[model samples]
Target: MATQAHRTKPALGEREMIVLMALLMSLQAFGIDAMLPALGQIAGEMGADGNDRQFVIGAYFLGAGAGALFPGAFADRYGRRPVLAVSLIAYIALSIACALATDYTMLLAFRLIQGFACAGLSVVPAAIVRDHVGGDRMARLMSLIMMIFLLVPILAPAVGQGILYLAGWRAIFGMMAVMGVLVGVWAWLRLPESLTEENRQDINLFPILRNMGTALTNRGAIGYVVGSALVFGSLFGFLNSSQQLIAETFDQGENFYLIFGGAVVGMVAANFTNSRIVERFGARRVGHAALLALIAISFAQLWSASQPQQPLYQFIILMSLSMASLGFIGANFSSIAMQPFYHIAGSASSAQTALRMSTGAVLGALIGSLYDGSAKPLAVSMLSCALVALAFVLFSERGKLFGRKVPSPD
Candidate 1:
């Protein structure tokens, strides 16, 4: 079992710590979303046929899922700082490789490596929070981190678009390479090693796998994780299709990214609200309610898409609402699932992140394959995934879906 230690002094100010953590975590999202604007350029350059272009994004998530499992154990064994340094350096190198890729296969390969390098950035900050805070405070801290994370989806595409206009798609990856290097240096200099020697676990695959097994065996944990994954899958389906949907359905070509950025505004607002409400309402209650809202909005989107007078504005409004609800669901579900596994937080986080990313990749792939120059596939997939997530949450909570006591982080 992992033991806790109280420090004589606070490590960092809450706002500064949360902001830095947010910057680290947001890199994963930036690497994925920021490139959306350049997908067409990349496709044309590499002769990518149809939806096969999505493999570029899907491969990153696949690598990230696989990558998340090892870093936590390494952090627990060596230290968070060292593991983070190595991961960031890998990310920098891979980003440069991605920028220089001459073919689709090479780009995809480097994206996978870049995704793997992001694992430490995503997992380590949360572990550091666990190393310091507990229970409701940890949940709040996570909510704060997520609020900052919410900014990536809001700004990354715009950044990518600006780069596209100035220098071209290649510059986006070049910028990412620079960002990785800077963040790595910042981490090496500023971030302390949160995992002390006494708290370190035996660094082995078997023990880590065993801890993952324990987390998987917990009904509530599994339900929350799976439910979160499905919800995330629904979002990923939309993300995978958004550029095409905007271009084809709305006849907005180069301006598609601008509209996508507009949709993310709703998500940022929702996350900011979630930061305030999560403590008072509890993660489960807020998550369950948000899932219901997501389902309803998705259904509305499906109905709207089925109509003859289906306007792009209608689709935009419904999608905005759906995305907004996602902000509420993401962090809450993760915190609820991780609450019970304080002793094995690293393995638990690895399992949950793996499940979420793998589910997103599969669902995104399915959505990408079904692209038919319309919004139907995207709407159908979103509604279906939302319904499935709602069902899982209902079953996981044994029909007590709202107002339940927040489980203490044990």
Candidate 2:
């Protein structure tokens, strides 16, 4: 490890890199959010019911999570830009495949593979950021990226709904393909390789396994990764069930995107605020406070769900507040998790990201599958995940909460 990463800097400034990473990473969010409005229709047309419809979301996550394990090692061997190009290309092709699928099973299959391709987007960007900066500076950059990245959730469902109205849901995949191509072209042209020659690892299986094992067992980083996964499970569970909750349960089919976007608006604000304050306050302190806030909000959500009459406004407010807390938690958690890895950022990022995605996806699918015309399952699962996350944070801190430790990378 070396602190001289500044000497091997890419041509792009911090702002440019942040914007590029946000869009690149937002591809995955766009894939999920833009399809939310069309889930019911897709289900109806495909003649599926219950948990099967949810697999459209779950299967993609499953693939992405499983697939996330390798891209970073590959990026470590080759370079960030080329491996990311492969991911984007796979994404474009699979979006088309998903669009052309004749049945529900076929669609899920394509989405799963598309998710596999998107893993590159998830790992490479974070590795790239670590390539340039470390510690709280890295956390601020990640928070800024997240602030822009979250806009996809706010706008994508609306875009999906519009496509559902104008040309049909298949065109939404077409939109994804076009966006993929555009982003791919932009990245190909402008995004420089951040992995320097000296840090590049050979394509050896033993070291890959060893590095991945280290990533998994690093006590300092493991808790934040796993805890973040649990918190994200709450978000994923919401994604899995939100369409039905909006369209059928609440009788607000037309307002699904508006309501959902409103819920996410707070998160965007939180990310911006975190980006500004994380450096001064420290990632651990800020993230620890947010994790505690999530617990309190989850309790409120649980109470609302337990009532015979679960008010939609209460749900929306709680959703907003909970997600806002996540805005503070996610990036800082990720930055802290990647802090220990310098040269092996790609492998560490890949392993931890895989764990986060796999754990979150499995837990989310379970939560969503329990949907029974009410929000109790979601509320209970959310509180459970939040509490588990807090427990993991406690374990990571070894009973010292809100403590900031910036371990030297080199």
Candidate 3:
């Protein structure tokens, strides 16, 4: 019954595609950020160790990392829309399962499954974007996606807290389920298959591994992935510890979302700025300058925390700037890493995300577990991660820090 134009890729214009892709990518952030306000409630209800609540987030990252490894290959073999559709269905089911979980262990297991199912959100969209565009245009488009994606974290905590006040924490998961279904249905109706038949790969382990190997051997891809992973440790560490840091260390439980969202606004602003300037300045120049600024801010924060008593405003200001720096760094790093692998875009995206999430989860867990009733742990963790990330970036650039490469031709 549908017209031919309605069934083709042109049905969704560039802006429509960007919104859909951004929504697909943002589901993971919604899942994690919106659950922060409920962590305390869930831990108390299940009689879990207070210090161990970060596992809920860590488990998701781990499962997402593991789950991401296969989706790229599958998407490349089948088609992006079909893979995304199946993943969203499983994501919806797992969200419901999480809401029904009766114990801490059960909840964690369901969260892990939810994350695994959500992995397609992280992997497929990048490949789809790469299929359509590359070079500075790719950087600009990815920055736009990142800009939209950052908005979720800004509002997610408030949304979670509001739900907590209304129907309780479990209803948060219910909301996630409903979100998944809506997005899934919309995508099924409108998303065209980006992977053409001739470009599709066979669904074989050997070929998948081979593609991964090729991706790994590319110095630009590997360096950027490792750098991004280490840099991401700072973000993961913050997420793991933020709920406690605000509620306990700062004794601002009542104003948690307001304070958290305020800092995230800095990131949103930076992302917007990056999207506008990346094409003219190049991703490398923007990312490297931001990385340097982040490192300096990290060290400054660490120094301030070493004083007899650091001001709360100082900590918030520094952290906001750090997050803003990440806004510039993340999309550029990912775009640069994937720049060298258009032919194997799906596999490359999967490998990059899996490595980044898995490594970040481990480092974040370590940093979070070291929370010692002060901001020292977080500041120190950010500084250490930034240092390592800088080294990786320099290595990847062969000691050069600000040169831009032309996007590989499709």
Q: Could you give candidate 1's per-residue lDDT for residues 1-410 as a string of tens digits?
A: 12234343336577878888888888788898988888888889899888877777888887887788777777677666777777778877888888898889988988988887778877778777777766556677787888888888878888998999899988998888888777766666566666655677897778988887877778787888888888788678777877778776788877876789787777777878888877788887788888899989888888998886579788878888988898888878888777777766676777778778877778877887788877877889888888888777777787778857565543
For candidate 3, the lDDT comes to 0.85
Per-prediction TM-score? 0.95, 0.97, 0.96
Model 3 per-residue lDDT tens digits across residues 275-371: 8998888889999999999999999999988878778788788888999999988888898988877878898888888888888888888888998
What lDDT tens digits, residue by residue, belong to model 2 across residues 1-410? 11123236677788998999999999999999999999888999998886678899999999999999999999998888878988998989999999999999999999988898789989999999999889988888899999999999999999999999999989999999999999888787777788888889988999998999998888888899999999998889999999888887778999999999988998999999998998888999999999999999999999999899788999899999989999999999999999988989999999999999999899889888989888888889988999999998888889789896554353
Clashes of each: 0, 0, 0
**Highest TM-score, which number?**
2
Model 1, position 317, has a per-residue lDDT of 85
Compared with the true structure, model 3 gives a TM-score of 0.96
lDDT of 3 at 130: 92
Against the unseen true structure, what C-alpha lDDT does each candidate score?
A: 0.79, 0.90, 0.85
